[model samples]
Target: MRRTGPTTVTPVKDTGPPGRGLLYGLGRACARHPWRVIGVWLLVLLAAVAADRAWGGSYADDFDLSGTPSRTGSDLLNAHGAAGSRGVAAQIVVRSDAGPLSAHRDTLTAAGQRLTALPDVISVAAPLDTAGAVTDDGRTGYYTVRFRENPAQFEKSYVGRVDAAVRALRADDVTVEYGGPLGQLARPAAADRASEAIGIGTAVLVLLLGFGSVAAAGFPLLTAVIGLLAGLSVLGLLASRYAFAAASPTLATMMGLGVGLDYSLFLVTRHRKLLHSAEGPVEATARTVATSGRAVLVAALTVTAALAGLFASGVDFIGMLGVAAGTTVLVGALAALTLTPALLGLAGRRIDRWHVRTPVDEPDDSGDIWHRWAATVRRRPWTFLLLGLLGLGVLGAPAAALRLGHVDAGASPVSYTERRAYDLVADGFGPGADGPLTVVVTLDKDHRTTGAQRDALARALRDALTATPGVAAATPPKATEDGALLVSTVTPDTGPQARATTALVHRLEDDVLPGVLSEEGATGYLTGTTAAQQDFRDILADRLPVVVGVVVAAAFVLLLAVFRSPLVALKAAVLNLLSITASFGVVVAVFQWGWGSRLFGIDETVPVESYVPMMMFAIVFGLSMDYEIFLLSRVRETWLETRDNHRSVAVGLAGTARVITCAALIMTSVFLAFLLSTSVVIKMLALGLGVSVVLDATVVRLLLVPAAMYLLDEANWWIPRWLDRLLPRLDPEGSRGRAESTGAAVPAGRVTR
Candidate 1:
């Protein structure tokens, strides 16, 4: 627990030049005082948890669309005291298997009365009180319950009381189910503990196979778990102060675990390699941090940068998701640099203890498959390049048909009460009744019209809306307390996310409302949960291109600066884009095209979740760069020494291939584990990310990169003098220390002919 800087560790024998001095210094400092480093991390985790308890934020589907029609209508309703800012509505669906619901009217009425009496319950309208509440068949009925605030903000006990009151009416012949936001509150928790267990278990198996020692294999998992806990704690604190989506924590955890393990794996692999040549534990740790630790830092920064690029999405909720994920990645990098080395120091030579088999030595190409593959790629680069492009093209084709929208309760599992209620209502009242839009009409304050004129205008507006092509029905207009506002409910003939329904909403706003309200000196706005979700979808679609452009531009600039080669940077950008597109195509095929929906527990095709594409693009783009940098850094190092593209490409591929493959497998396993989640969005993310990693590591990195580099030859290193001067030198491996530590010479015996 000393408070002194790391003293330089001189190798017993000079290898070449000193490498990665900053990272080595930091690692040496942590190694010298392992307990202090571990203790500080523990304190940070505890403090974050405490802060979260005192002032933690809650996750909600709250979206801010200031200029959209939904916002205007919402403002009008709240202005006239007709609706609370956080008002929520729930449906109580009742059906009788043996007889008509009318037979249980008295019981239903009593239950409605009970619901109305519950705390936070604004009112409850029984089936008998509203003409449309009863289905034409007479066996099914529903009641409407409005709440004063969003159910997410309500106390947990409140939902239990409401559940009790609603279930009280259930008889031998009657079935009662809840729907809407209340049903969401009542749904059982879907924990990812099982997913985490699976991911970690798989990682352990992979690590054991790769490292051949129990302690060495376990170290990565231990550091990753601790790092993930710290990241989630910090995310909780951020959520308390800001608006985050319900998916933020899950997404962040996925990223944290994947990167945490990968970063630690890289350093551990390097440490094990250096252990054979270095004089002692101190020098080996220092050299490992100096080289692989620096790569982890650069890779982590690239990921954070890509995530932060989500701000270009222009949606506050989506942007906050970026913040949540980016924060965790940053913490993961810090843990790799500090906590990982400390643990390694503590393990010392015993890291190879508790062996399952003999530990593998540093990667070399002596009769290795990777070396043979590299030689093949070099000999026929054109063939590999064409094959890789053709495969990516086929996989990416489905992306052209991608549709963006929200998934409704109908998509939930049959066991969920919400899904049951959704089915019941759809059978009785038509699919459109499950999602209805509200139209709010407000007269300008300076209007000269009299009260009678206002009434006439309201009637005309209602008739026009009902007559709209896609609108199934429009209720008669009702006036607010101040008489300045008129509200009517409109139901579409199609389901909420259907293209027909979206068309109906737009037509009502753009064609119907403007024409009808012009004569009355009033403006009409469409607002409701359905309307709001549609607006969110539209906004995501519009801003997606901008988000992609920003991310690509930033990553390209970063690569160009670091590699100092325009062709290399451009190749990285193109290959990453191909990987992302292919992954998107897979998502579209499975989720939207219903190709494998049943396998994933999806009942039917749902539009791609609106924010998913943007989220995936930023994440995949950044992550693809990780392997790009890791592999290319070694290539650049070799090319600088040999000045022979063929030799450098072969040597670099042989040295880094095993580590990259192992890292990719570890990440892919972590992402795939989340497929066990019941949440559809989580499933989509898990599949997309997992698939992207597989493609990037195998097809893009192994096949295409070598083929492309071999084809380009000296052109890959060509940089315009002016541009090279403008870009800052970004040697991921320290310039002065690299040669003295790891040395520039390739293993002479292992080099491919």
Candidate 2:
């Protein structure tokens, strides 16, 4: 980018005096008007509850790229009153020692007929019959049913109904097992409910442990609740404008709660520490706002920029997530700056009611492990670099084999009406019965789809797709007045079958299919669960680099502006990167690589959805930076007076370390709490993020950063002379380049409210 201006530094002005004035202001505010703050929040909560009832649901379809296939295909289905179809089928399986289909064909046929009559049933394809139904062993038999409409939507509604109907057919003489997308979707909601409960409880426990005070822990949670409510309320309105989906809100809820809690924790902990020195609560609160508040602002901006980068992928569904997540972070940051300080002013010393008693009157002020870490790194920068590089390389190794798959939100579960319908189809037929790929062929200009082209297209598709690693078969192409389309059967096996096979299908569509038909004057677009999933992956890949670049570049500039010393800014940027990377490394190892997939209830075999990495990056980066800014701002504060780099870093570390550690522990627990979710995706994400935050706080921030910075010494404060003259002064009274606005004593009345 472009060079902006030179950095400027100003002499530090002490704001640490005026002791009782600071403490009494907060006490007076609390002693005078506590209920006003409570009343405002209560009103907001009521409004939120109303909004939730009015506009909370009905936005789930926003994620359905299912309808995004060539609008022509959508229109075709629609014209036939099937336009909005989900393009999936249901499978049901029944086992009986009643001999063979010839023996009990009547009971089987009756079951199939009853299913065909279900409201969502488009049509039931013929029974698998003896020819198709029997497994190699006479012990098992399969039957099939074709759906009237898309199996995806069908599962969302009718699968469970069909499953119950089929089970009613069960007697002491027979046994049944159901499998299919529908069956998966209809699985009990218990897992999801359990996951959510566990996640919340875990987060609370972590917060309690981190703050060592229920009040401190409670503040973050309360702030998070407000932020979540506000985010959802605003998203509800936006949902109508952009067709936002239910998944976005669900994901956003966790993200908003986690980030909101963490951001506030950073500020609250720092402010509390500053107050421990006997600064009036109002002054401490304002200083915290001026310093940590700036960090939160800059951090939120970086996160929003990163999330918005997802828009480059050209997939509306993923794009919606980017927007929703970005919005939540922005709103949370705003709440942190405004509501957090206001509440702190009101709570006053009571805010410390839950604070663990400390033997020392003032906060601890001694160099500990971080000091030793800094000394070692300062003495051995090269070794640290080498180790970091090697670790990143290892963590990234899985990228090569990462598979991309889409599990139908509705189909992946094993409860409800839809899943049962799916099992019925699978038992009666085959696993690929639920959602098969639909390939649409459009004739090239001046070249109609002739019989030769049609025949060749069908043959080429079969040749390329049939018997392909994961494909069950490729059926013949069918022609309508508009075009010719073919359906491919994909039967996923256990483990990562859905993800791996889906990835293979997209490769076929983008590479194999185009080559196969290059001479046929017909181009094809793949539309189905597999293709849509692949498209989403492509979108994430496209957007990730842009998002990372934006976040890094913006953060660098912001840091430089705040610190004045390009060296400090560079250190900030580099340390932040290491922290975030290490966090992601842990997430990938544990969640993606299946190191502990069973414990976390994740499918190690399943390639994580493409968007998950980007989501993790956005969230983790912001949180990591929260600590970075909080701790470093304090360091910069000390450096201004001490003028000794080592002393500055040491004092700063001791001053902020305990609070940062506590905040991180709470954040980690909160994120890990998502491990309780029944949704595998949620579990994976929550566990990954939680583990990463914990790692960042301890390994990267506590140990690595100090060592690296200590080695740099005075070099960490270097700023080019010309740039120094040109850059605007960031902090006129505190650190030379603090980006926060100058603090002025608020009028007594303003401070009172």
Give stretches of model 2 more than 4 Å off: 1-13, 16-33, 58-214, 229-250, 276-279, 327-331, 350-356, 359-364, 367-401, 407-435, 443-471, 481-507, 510-516, 575-593, 602-604, 720-753
lDDT of 2 by residue, 554-579 (tens): 66676676666676677666666665
Q: What lDDT, from 0 to 1, does candidate 2 have?
A: 0.59
Question: In candidate 2, what residue range of length 10 has the lowest lDDT sum?
Answer: 744-753
**Candidate 1 residues 1-753, lDDT tens each?**
221222222222234435546777887887778889889988987887788777777666667888888988988898887643346778889998878888887888888899989988887889877878888888888888889876755545777787678675774458888888777776767688888898898899888887798877887888888889888888887876788887888899899999999888888887887777787777778777877777788889899999988989888888888898888888888888888888888888888888888887555644787788899998899999999999999999999999898888888888888889999998988889999899998887743246777778878998898889988888898778778788898988988878788889889989999999987688899998889988999999999999999999998998988777889999999999999999999999999999987888887888899999999999999999999988898887777666668877887788788778888998998899998888889889999999999999999988999999999886787776577668876766553355444544321111222
Q: Which segments of model 1 are wrong by more than 4 Å?
A: 1-14, 17-20, 42-57, 83-86, 98-106, 171-174, 444-448, 736-753
**Predicted structure 1, TM vs. truth:** 0.92
Per-model CA lDDT versus the true structure: 0.83, 0.59
Error of 2 at 107 (Å): 7.8
User: Positional deviation of 5 in candidate 2, in angstroms?
Assistant: 15
